[model samples]
Target: MATRPASDTQVLAGRPFPLGAHPEAGGVRFAVTSAVADAVEVCLIADDGSERRIELTERTFGVWHGLVPGVTPGQRYGYRVHGPYDPSRGLRCNPAKLLVDPYAYRVTGRLTNLHAAQGFVGDPARGPASTVDSLGSVPLSVVMSPGGPDTGAKPEVPFEESVIYEVHVKGFTEQHPFIPEALRGTYLGLAHPVSIEHLARLGVTTVELMPVHAFADEPSLIRAGRHNYWGYSPLGYFAPHPRYASEPGREVEEFRTMVAALHAANIEVIVDVVFNHTCEGGPDGPTLSLRGLDAPAYYLHTKRGHMADITGCGNTLDAGSPTVVRLVTDSLRYWTQELGVDGFRFDLASTLGRPRGGMFDRDSTMLTAITTDPVLSGCKLIAEPWDATGEGYRVGDFGAQWAEWNGRYRDTVRDFWRGVTGVRDLAFRLSGSSDLYDHNLRRPWQSVNFVTAHDGFTLRDLVSYNDKHNEDNGEDNRDGTNDNRSWNHGVEGETEDAAVLALRTRQARNLLATLLLSTGTPMLTAGDEMWRTQGGNNNAYCLDDETSWLDWTPSAASEPMLAFTRRLVRIRAESPALRQPEFFEGRTTVTGKPDLVWFRPDGEEFDEADWFDEDRRSLCLWIDGSNSQARNREGALVTDHSWLLVLHAGDEPLDVVLPSREYGETYKPTLDTSTADGTPAHPGVLEPKGRITVEARSLLLLRAPRDIVEGPQTP
Candidate 1:
């Protein structure tokens, strides 16, 4: 191969200690890792679109290094690694293809699905090296100045008190009327005063933004004129997605500004990171950054050189490799330390804990490394805890330090509120799913419980659609999950019948109540509190338009629902017994009462037969806050007034007899989900063993005074 002269710009052998292009005092040093490549050329693209090829003269421990004297920050560059182009051996190195830097701080342009971008010269069907230069086809990695130190402090809310709100940065503010048109759907919009005030009023402790890493639209989606709206298909892990920024080259700063703003509002920021796979699909996919550099080292491959697709995204990252582990850990540290992010929620997290050709391991190298690392261990680390590979549904199998998205909690809560499952499963879920997470010395907060997320139906759709409406995804309605435990409440989709609409509203309240009142770290999807809908689209991952954006316009149910949600959050915050950190021991404590007691509608403790009774849907839970095992910050035992929570999932209102005088002498109603403002018209006191009416598909909380008093039962 012929090389261009280095006469125009002086090049020197640079140090290979730090990867990617780093701008120093006089020039920029470029370093990239390509273990199997025989030659590597760093192409510097000038403002006029002219290219200067500088071959890296020094190779240190598989890293090619070169320094360009005149090149500085904002210089657009890419790599062309030369080696054998043999895909069967998992080595597809094509010098003609302009490759992205794995550690690119910012990517300048978008990638088009053109034939020239392919590694092969001719049709990819024949599998031959591409002699055509791909300099103009692929995006260039821009050399960026290192970000300054984060002087802002992170809002490290304790897990027991945290209420997470998962939102897509773009979708959350895309249609907000209060935000300026130029700033809408950008990081600045998310950090706007209106956004922060709404979140502060709603009482969420953390805002878990879905994947913001620099990502690419899949070639197939582009071919079909669709887009990957979720931003899960990552291209560079270190860079923030440029599309979400207000201006060019300001993504990192804008992301930091958003984090600072949220922190100022006492809300933590948890970014949803997708390190399990890349936009570069299967073995026949495009030759992007990692694939062109060293596919075998970065991705898991079968014996025949095929990609091991555990993430269902074509290729699963081989976290077992030290190189990949270093890359992931470094990326996380950068986000937490430099960008001021408080935590991370790993997407497809099971893939990170699974070994090659093995099941998901609780003690995987990646899991141990993350939990033991000093910086990451101090920060919150949450896992989705499941993938699409073999036995990947390890919900509670993650390390003790890590919290998991409790899938069992989600399913059981949905089933119970849908009025299909029995009270037994509901009881288990309400108590933070001890059956799934209790064995590993995990606390209740370790289970991040939620009814819906970005991947599934929104809370409104959960009560409006019985089936997923994903035809707009351009996949012929074949995409998205089928096991949506949803009920349409008398009619499918929107309804005009007053009774039907009322029932839907009631059911939505019931679901939200269960999620908040349950003993776990509850996660609320962004617009669930205001009854946002996706028009029955359960999987809006591909719908970037109105179907996915949160409509700020108030609907008929918006005010009441928002008020109810705010009240629920306030109640959860005020009541320590509802959000206990420890598991219920089911035994008497120092206060001479069990921390938790279950009662049937007849005011009797649940028997074994009652647990197995499928028809039993309403039950009463007496939580003895005075007997709580949780301790306060000063190491003293915390104490609060006892409380009673009545849950009724049946179709008709039921009269529930309060537990006998032994539990408490007097009870006062605190919250009722059936009421528009979550407060009853007439405040009343009830004697022990008194009967209180609970509406259909509603939840009620009663405060039981610690001091015993003989009081008359008020109807």
Candidate 2:
């Protein structure tokens, strides 16, 4: 692939359909969408450090395109769109500042010099466009081939059976001792043998990796000497973040390799994506990719020309626009079809479903496009179903095809364990949040239930800290969430008292047990199984160092919690009743027993009176496996022993009376969260209607004998 002569570059009018730089046998054809630009030029940087500027003479519709007969794949380039710089009219284009392709597959370098990256070259305070050229300072897009060899088959785990482990790519392996020093904190590091072994041992079917898309640190964070460790601020939608790649120019391949490795281990890879906003902040922000190309069309703006801050981020992408929708859909297809991702978890997903300046609608253009798109509909889709704007807390409103992060489950469970709420809300969470998700013919698994996530406290810190400890995040500790429903067991922070440590450990187990055994798709934070803590920092989004990394060196408390979590997962896997595919309707089965039964501590059926009992800290749930509608590998109806799970969140142990023999004759204890091996103090079968002791702030699971025949009872 030789460089084309200036004459050929000047004369060739390229095809404009593909919308990015496409490498062909003769040369590369460049195309970009800039509806408002008067002129667009493709600035190609050669291997010899020389630059060639080719004005895209062809315009089909709103796209500017041209071809250079010799430019090949590996050539670096950027776009220079000539347009007005009027802010009030929402046009912020400046040809002086080099712009990245909105569909760039790979980008090199960072936006270190903000002033040079901004469209306004002079004093930003004066709000005027800069006349100086930014070709020397801004990062350039590297043209690359679009397709690759198939990296094996995806695991394609079903949502009902999937257990998601949300993890940060770099932070997950940053302190991993088993990973090689050079590979640690990179894409390759996540696919390391040790990382795979940990996930496999923990029994998670999917690894929901935090954002790996190319992102930039906020200028405010840069000035404060802090970085966005979570990678929520996206820079390039098509490219993997280069900082997470072990080697230069191999970010895409490295990401594909990671996905392949996880697939080989039968674990799916789901990435958390931020399409709600870009790193380009408010009106005073820099002009990088879409903002510079056409801010008015790319972002949702108020009538006064200010950005609609629906994401709490300074700017929100106009997902309703046809151009932005195409960009998003194309990017999703690239990741799933080309990069081999199993799924995606959209952050602030409600923002994507909002029509310009309107409320969030389930039938909004972007949401409907995604769920109906042939390429994307086949892949798993998860939504963080809310934004920071009006009516954004839509936990169960994202239709049946999409699963949601149940924020209500998190808050209710935390409140229950903290003794701030009664058994009513706790029962709802434990039963897969049926009240929230059951309206639209949704199954139990539509609720992705969890008590902790990346944006909140770790399971360990949740028990050790009463309030968020984020002073180190700067901004005088005002950045993170303050309403962290956490409870410190006697002490506020780290304590040396054995009694306090014991209570904290038990509370941690209680939370983990509830999360794994609950009737929904449970998601565990990466380090929660190993008792990882952020030093009480509920939000460590800014701390890229030790504060956010998982400490591989386990503590005394971590070992037991890890063992307990593994045992809980195993029990859940063995018991089909625990992970029911459908919502429990309380209908009487052929066995003369309800498919699901709820009881008070005294062995009586729970009535309306028991729900509002403020002092009630315990409840008993019986799940009938015989009522399951799932089929096994042999195409036979799946059935297992019925299970009775007793959960007590009180401060003292209590005697729980078992249900009558009408349900089953005898029960065998399977798991007790208070014990290291999930063993009960008195192991063995207990007669039906017998009393068993449940420990304080812990959960117990018992399996009913399969041989016991159902007795005659009234339906």
Candidate 3:
């Protein structure tokens, strides 16, 4: 039980419509949702560390409200919910724990003492409520002025044409040479000219920032002297993380500036959001905001009153409830409308779809709200498409208006480049994955394709390492996934062998080219284009030091790869054949050829029986864009150049015969992965039936000419 404050502060009954602490003309109206609290007090903390408590006298529909006079902007405050301490019933509320407002737009501090915030005295699940005052140790919510960002014109790039680049805010800017020393590793640093210039040059239309929502490091990590550098354990969804802001007390403004800079560069901003779970862990975890307010209503509980740990993060929010739906949608609208973010990439999104009984539903309340919200009408929504539980992998299961991270696309492409498969599934992956995403009228762009992401071996590492080396993470080399479909070309880790090094570069190019040229929207991991590696550490979630920070220095491997990547992006942008919104129809075109055809190296088209040839390692994807069945926004047919992409993953070089004149009269070399910098190995044009040798473990991209052509291109 909490004693009332000593000082006399006038408190009036405030209306409870919009939740959270909002400052108006008279004062700040504080409203908190606690379905099971006996009484609630808005504890105002002074700058000098003293606290004044004002009890909210009005209770309407499980919400407690009060208008505390004289409370202005920058006033730090918390909540003390007085209620039952019955863990068996999932109502573990204790006034001793200072609770943050679930709708707080800005929080000012970190939880220094973890144990002091726990509600129980002995065993956390069965013991009595502790009386330790968590006033000075816990984080406090600050009242903010209702001022939105001065965002200029929004780029609003169409979904099908988007090329996403997933980046970490700190790692991307921490070592940037041109960023100021003071601003490095901050949001303003990312907004700087050099950062924007790099992104613009890379041709990425969207930057999916990893978790900008305020998060807390795990207590286990704190005890081990490590940090959760990924920012997945969210503490406040509405706030821009203060750790990334250069100017203290101005995180919202700094984040807005970063968004504005990206918009100015014709890029969209998409934040990775974790709304499934929070920093408040399980039944034994600390008494954070949601747990202290009403654990049963805020968290999913088992029949035995234990918190459902489906997220593998302890507590899973009961998204089926109307309260949780309102919470998530409100947070999304705030980020979209106030701070000026263009999109969101939902982390562990499968849990949100599973609103009840641990069963996933496509039409859950939370999903429906986001899909229907007018505020989020045209915003891009990308889901990670899985959760911690084994049953949460719902790829291609998302309904209308939502895109999913295509895991199958990544696996198939990696396996194909590593010579681990025939071109059966590889063909499916390369041509929009129609089998997976063509249901319910989902287009090819609905499958966000990638060969590598934030939590796996990088593109360079995928070709250079066969096993994970996570010993630096202090997990005794027992962290990260083991099923890496990667081939190290008979050499593991770094080596001095010239042949092996050349092979690794080519393999990397093969993977990157496949990702960029695929028919779905590609999402490239940051720094992968410049030969970035984590020393084979697939999981760098806890390592915040230089091991995780992106090295911005140019080197022998970095410069060539960057140039190659830039050229590839340009090729993809210029070539409409690669950006097909519709899957191949196999229909005859105006040129008396099929819209899509798979040809063998012998200049013969692949028959139906050729798909089951398990030993075959080469295939050609021919796209006839001139008679393409795809349409623009106006539903008019688009016509572009026809293309032929050749992949030969065999150990020996093989001579490839160009297709006959039905597709095109001659072939113009566009890019060859065998070259060190994606240069054309064949500098001159080759006529029909001509033979060109594709070296071991490489790919070649060629375009058909309307007439005579000028040889291959140089980046």
Candidate 4:
């Protein structure tokens, strides 16, 4: 050990109110929370790889605090928590393994030697503590400037008007030819004029970026020369992934600039956060930040000290513990205030509500803390709403404050287009799933509806492949989910058959139109609009090459698909009846017409029996947009145009009639998914009771003339 620092001058007692290392006027104030450690040493590392260890003598509550007089900003450091290494009690504090600061705003270095960072010597689950020093193997924390969170202005878009785009930071900009070579795959690349222009044109109000938090690839993958491309394994919450930054040692500024640019484009930034678990796998895994500091308080464990892996990620963070709750809440607040992000999408969110005993609770301590938080409560909160275990899947159980990724909507919509489901479940999904989210004062927007997300197949692949092709994942092609409800039109993978290709394009259009026109917030996956494909690899989470990156120069179908997607977005922006604030009741609206009425192909209202008929695949929705129940953001009443949406899933085309005079006076065709383009080249203007032929496996949207027309809206 290095010589002890002079307690009088070199080390001074510091406050422990805010954890993490913060550079002050003279030096840096270091504070870390650890309940089971006997002592904590702040190890400062020089450029030459030499470390000077200073023991923090003052202990307040569960936090250790000390101030070093000569510490400056950007100085590299870490902690060596000294305590018992008893695995039976779930305590694994080893001074040999240099632990990362839980609240580290920035972390540097790479994890090269997995075993060197492990705490145990023999059988990792139960063995003597290792004497090997991890200072040369693991990453170290860096001191950041002292400040409150960033107060940059946010778009603050309402859920009713938000169209979220889920994109990976690297994959989004990697293949863009217009972006400069140096800025490609960096934070500045996403914020560049070209990137912003694409998002603006797509009409996405918010960009829900996949994990940009500092992460580490699994040791098994590292040894195999593969990486966790999606970045689900988080190493540091506060630190933005340094790989995305264009300038070295300036990742914070670069991330802030990216947020500022997106906000300027009227788009909100929502980061996908992984607070349910850490990079540390299990008792047999390596000793990272939380695992090495105080495993009992940070992780949920069995009585024998083995991790209770509810997330199927080797270990589940104990959300029930106050220490863990504080860490999560503080991290959220820090990201919100300091980083200028508008919201968060919690990954495996069910684990956050499972306080104790591995059962999910809506009123868990963790949920309450975030809801009651002054800064975080106002920010948009989206939940994945599921975990790895069967009992952890708690969809539609989150409160009104949260919007969930509606897995049912995704499954039902896919099934409807694939001819596997009847119109009853499809109707419930299309009209804002009241059966699942009607309670808790939840509005229609609480369901963050999505047909294709980051975890599943892209929209292009969803129609081109009936099964997953994950052979390159090195998991024997058994890694991705087998429950993909997809259709290949006729042939699998890639083909030059024009008939099959045309049908595939139509199917893709049907899915996208359903998602955007549904009565909830819609999330579009990146590169879906450009007809990007992974060659049917539904689980391309490991292959980070061309298999994952968005190819701007994609198929010839790219132009039409991208144009159709933008048209759908514009149509949703112009029609409020399509994205209603309240559930449709089939009652009279302000126009003295039914708020929403389901009709048969013969222009008759759907009876109870028609809904459950398995053969019924065609349905027409007459939505009265004279919305008396809706109030704008300024608390003013707003009325939009009524719409007649016709959907047909059968193979043969059918003749459909418009509703009588009671529903509308005249209708103009706004969109037709059957056409090569989204709109018909020669549309026929007609009155009520007029007849038209609806093509198979297609959707048509006809708008009722609005006396008070609203212009095209953003997001």
lDDT of 1: 0.85
lDDT of 1 by residue, 438-550 (tens): 97778889999999999888888998899988899988888899999999987889889888788788888888888998998999999999899998888778788999999
lDDT of 3: 0.87
Evaluate residue 234 in candidate 4 and report its C-alpha lDDT on the 0 to 100 scale: 94
lDDT to native, each model = 0.85, 0.85, 0.87, 0.88
Per-candidate RMSD vs. true structure?
Answer: 3.6, 2.9, 3.3, 2.6
Q: Which stretches of candidate 1 lie over 4 Å from their true place?
A: 1-4, 121-126, 148-151, 631-635, 707-715
lDDT of 3 by residue, 392-426 (tens): 99998988788999999999888887777888999
Cα displacement (Å) at residue 107, model 4: 1.0
> Candidate 2 on 338-454: residue-level lDDT in tens?
899988999999988887947878889999999999989998899999899658878889976899999999998889888777889888888888899888778889899999999
TM-score of each: 0.96, 0.96, 0.97, 0.97
List residue ranges in candidate 2 displaced over 4 A. Answer: 1-8, 47-50, 121-126, 633-635, 707-715
Error of 3 at 674 (Å): 0.6
The TM-score, computed over Cα atoms with residue i paired to residue i, of candidate 2 is: 0.96
Q: Candidate 4 — which residues are off by over 4 angstroms?
A: 1-9, 147-151, 709-715
